[model samples]
Target: MTTTKALLIGQRRRLALTMVGGFAGVVALALAVAVVADLADIRTATALTDRLVPLLVFYAPAPIAAAGAYARCGGPACLTVGVVPALVFATLVVAGTVFGVPGVGGGDAPLGGVTMSFALVGLSGAFVGYCAGVTAALLADLAGFGGDGGDGGDGETDAAE
Candidate 1:
């Protein structure tokens, strides 16, 4: 009986999926920031990075991460959903800004001074998405949407058996 219950994901699994998505988004955003930073000429790269990296990071990755989590984890959600993204964001910040990866991550000094603007933004977005997904899933279950009704979406009916 492949019912809605079967389709429903556990809280732990949903959280895991959310974290995975968030990590993927954060990593992609970090790479983009680095690439963008390196796009400018030596004379203007620092200025461009200082102005652009933060915006790109703020606008791009957070949504991607949140969407991934929301789509996969339609459950009550968990702490990991937020923690993973935050950790990933913090790691990237430390690596890109603190380690001073020359020619990337904004480098040292005025070059790499933009990531801090939205360090928590990505995590917060993922958390919100996860929460929404959880609420949606719960409401669906409450509405009896999870029941098999002897007819799963796959077209297989209990009458056939």
Candidate 2:
């Protein structure tokens, strides 16, 4: 396959893994927090704004995991792989938030004031996650963690080497 096509395929796989892992993590975390908060009598579990904190927190890890997976592929395009997951997450979150909240607009427009604000918040969270994931991948590349540098774990060598 062409290089661009291969990269796209790799990115898609990374995104899928990120979504699956992220969803599982978020569910598990929500349940755990619910149990603990119930025992502790903390009302933040049901509070509207407070719940956003956990949502952002739980969502952060998925992109990091995706970046790690992408870094394993070991190429100059690792950052691109990291970014794909973040964009995917952001898009989904923004679309969901905007649609879930009902608003009456004169036109057929999708978002209203409150919903737009929520979408922005979700987008910011996704941006942070994306930056984090890309940073992790870049750091790994610099540290020679997953590059095709003949580390011998994969029993392969770069042709240029």
Candidate 3:
């Protein structure tokens, strides 16, 4: 396959995997935290879990997707892909804070506090997920998992040549 095609595929796959894995990790972490703390009440844990799970998931793929896109498109696109999400997240957090949206981990808190917490959690999760994804994508690229290095004796390559 062409390098572009390979990169697109890799990016998409990496994004999907990163999202899934990150979400799963968040849920697992929340569960572990709840179990350890003996705060198994759904009301208490649910808010925290809800706030955290998506954030965990969102950031998980940022790096990987960026790397894959970079491998496919080169520096500018890679940088854009890597940076846009972070910018958006930051913007949202700022807006939410200015508007007094409660989004932090403390769902039991007031609306503004909760909004801030949620925003913080979501942004944090996305960042983390993105980092994980980028690292993984970079590693994969280094390992020659993505991109068209050369045809591996495929009949298509022979025909094209």
| Candidate with the greatest TM-score versus the true structure | 1
Collision pairs in model 1: none
| Span of ten consecutive residues with least summed lDDT in model 3 | 152-161
> Model 1 TM-score?
0.43
**Number of backbone clashes in candidate 2:** 0
Candidate 1 lDDT, 1-161, residue by residue in tens: 33333234332343446456655575556555555556544547656565655554444444443443333332323323434434454565467566675543434544223333344565566556555554554466578863334443334343434
Q: Estimate the lDDT of model 1.
A: 0.47
| Tens digits of per-residue lDDT for model 3, 1-161 | 45444433332333444544454454455544543334445676676766664544345335544443444333233323333333344444465567665452223445555445544544454445444545554667679874355442222232334
The global C-alpha lDDT for each of the candidates, from Candidate 1 onward, is 0.47, 0.43, 0.45
Model 3: CA > 4 A from native: 1-108, 147-161
Point out the higher-scoring one by TM-score: 2 or 3: 2
Scored by lDDT, model 3 comes in at 0.45
**Whose lDDT is greatest here?**
1
Q: How far does residue 32 in candidate 1 sit from its true spot (Å)?
A: 5.8
lDDT of 2 at 68: 40
Candidate 2, residue 85: the lDDT equals: 33
Cα error of candidate 1 at position 131, Å: 2.6
